[model samples]
Target: MKKIVTLFAALTIITFLSACGGGEENADAEEKKTIRFGATSGPYSDMVTEAIAPLLEEKGYEVTNKEFTDYVQPNKALANGDLDANLFQHKIYLESFAEEHNLDLSEVIIVPTAPMGIYSSEYKDIESVETGSTMGIPNDPTNLARALIILEDEGLVTLKEDVDPLRASLNDIVENPKEIQFVEVEAGQLPRLVDSEDLSMVPGNYALAAEMDLLSALALEDMPDDYRNRVAVKTEDLDAQFAKDIKEVVESEEFEQIIDEKFEGFGKPQWMKEEE
Candidate 1:
């Protein structure tokens, strides 16, 4: 009886040790495989949580998504090793942010642009804005210039000779023959001012926040190749596989369907392949 009891105890001990070792191995395997991403609130980030992340998971990747509300934090987090990647900014914003913070950031993939739109509370169309009608645009340099270019493209004003996208401003308007009121307001405040002003050009993010429909705008931002939408990763971790996964996710048809569903014709994902 004593010998049988001793053999059973030994067997139980061996089984427990084997189980512990297996658990450690499984944990090691799981630790070896996870991709982290940071994103801001709203449609851009929503698209990731709803569509992109799941699609990547289907390909055997474990994904970690960090949701943030502010624009500045995600990039900072990526720089500080708090996040592995972010998907909320365009190339121009990323470059400006990196320059301001003196961080090395690299864009892994080009994503969609939430094109700027010109909306009005009073006027039905661009033609209705008569002489001396007031107009409001974002005061930020990049967006202000972008809005001006759209105004110029609509033949509502004329920019200075040889001024490209960067150099556009009220001073560039040489042919404001209509004497339209061009007011510069803070980007976030533009939507609020629309009710008081004749027309306003606000960022798409803010416009969406204000519950405004972008499809009703008189004119929209022209989509360009270098027009500022990209998925950013730390310069050191911008490995080929990371780039491949991001590109595949961004260009996938699943992403396109989400855009169409959520934006409801107000926004669209324009890609270079379609342009080509």
Candidate 2:
């Protein structure tokens, strides 16, 4: 009788231990369903915190957002798996960065972008700027080309017909009707230089960071459809379940409403509009 009772007690204890272990394993699996995303500080980070993260949480995802101050680090972090994804660059910038770094990154979805614009505190309009005046443009190749295109559109300058617009440079300019002396400044610094420089070409993100109004731009870039900002992930992770969920959430009606309400005139929802 003593042996029988001892054996039964052992069996009961083993079963209880097994059940507790199983519960712990299940909790670990649930915790594994998390996403770590990277983004530049300012509007990109704002969107994720204000809208994207909450929507993801509602869908049972544990989301982590890491903010970056510069452009280069985010992609580097994503490529090394420090970040599962990133949202801070346009398609051209991402392609250029990936090629230079030899990293395999891919765009998941294009988000609304604040179009680049030529801003001036010294002049009310592009036409009012006197000949031989100085204009500030971004020094980075991609944005330098973009700024040059804006100059071409404004008739202040022209570029060689054969040159790719994405690769255009100061040397590519075939004409400078205004004889506008171009000053190369960092893209982020262009906004602050607006008062000193007769005119400055500023990226939409930088403009917003400087608290400048999008509508205040003297001339806005008719941004190419491909130039819109995107959420990027490692090519290998492109089809991962979390990545697919992110793409869906970004393109959902809930995300669109948040953007429309928060972003307002910053930029239109290219993804939503395309779906229509």
User: Candidate 2 — worst ten consecutive residues by lDDT sum?
Assistant: 264-273
Off by over 4 Å in 2: 1-32
lDDT of 1 at 263: 60
lDDT of 2 by residue, 1-276 (tens): 999999999999999999999999899668547889899999989888887889889889989999999889999999998998899998878998999999999999888788899999888888898999888999989889889888889888889999998889999998988899989988989997899988899999999999999888899997875678889999998888788888889888898889888985556555577776
Best by lDDT: 2
| Residue pairs with clashing backbones, model 2 | none
Over the stretch 96-119, how does candidate 1's per-residue lDDT look in tens digits?
Answer: 899999999998877665778888
* lDDT for each candidate structure: 0.79, 0.88
The stretch of ten residues in a row with the least summed lDDT in candidate 1 is 264-273
Instruction: Tell me which residue pairs clash in candidate 1.
Output: 90-228, 91-228
